[model samples]
Target: MFVKNGNCNFFSQKLTFNTLVVPSQPIIAPVGSDVTLPCQLDPVKDLRDMMVGWVRHDLTPGYIHIRNNHLDFLIDQNSLYLGRTSVSESRLQQGDMSLSLTRVRVSDGGKYSYFKCP
Candidate 1:
């Protein structure tokens, strides 16, 4: 699950059996560049029907990208990130939730959290 409380964004998940979601280490990118925030599920499972969300830690109502039911919902996404984020639809079933951020800006420098929920 993804929660936004004040200026922080929290990511959490409950496994039915034994599963893990691993996010990549801190990523650094230059301004005007692009970066991918890596995240994956250990012992992969199909995520086509799941809800995937990404948020910038310092932003409120910080939904960068939200995917569910094979569609991306961006109505609540942050204005700073509009038209600049995406996830690979074909790779969802492969457990990849990495977010591709284009034309990165200094304002985008911060921790990001990714979550996958059934």
Candidate 2:
């Protein structure tokens, strides 16, 4: 699943057997504002130790944000998303993997994809 933001797009995940869920409609956010791309696992498994990643299909490398072992790692992240994206650390243990984007931009409008390691 994917949450295409009007400004800052959010990514949703995919899994085998269990599915990743998100809003049915587009997330509309005004430019320069904040947006949360809602996503979660259906069976609600802990993700605190997992690597959750958000990517934009149109870009090279495509990663806008990444959290691994409950920490954000900026290596190879796209410059357009630098210092603009985050995921809730507290919520990860409950399976919520939403990505939050700060200072939405017009160029940020697009579909996104979410991925997880294990």
Q: Which candidate gets the maximum TM-score versus the true structure?
A: 2
Model 2 spans > 4 angstroms off = 1-16
Please provide, for model 1 over 1-118, each residue's C-alpha lDDT reduced to its tens digit, 9 standing for 90 to 100. 9999999999999856635555446678899998888777766777888898898768987888999979999999999999999998877888777789999998898777777777
Error of 2 at 89 (Å): 1.1
Whole-model lDDT for model 1 versus the true structure?
Answer: 0.84
Among residues 3 or more apart in sequence or in different chains, the pairs in candidate 1 whose N, CA or C atoms overlap within 3 Å are none
Whole-model lDDT values for every prediction = 0.84, 0.91
Ten-residue stretch with the least lDDT total in model 1: 15-24
Residue 25 shift from truth in candidate 1, angstroms: 3.3
- Candidate 2 whole-model C-alpha lDDT, 0 to 1: 0.91
| TM of each candidate vs. truth | 0.79, 0.83
Candidate 1 segments whose C-alpha is farther than 4 A from its true place: 1-24
The lowest-lDDT stretch of 10 consecutive residues in candidate 2 is 10-19
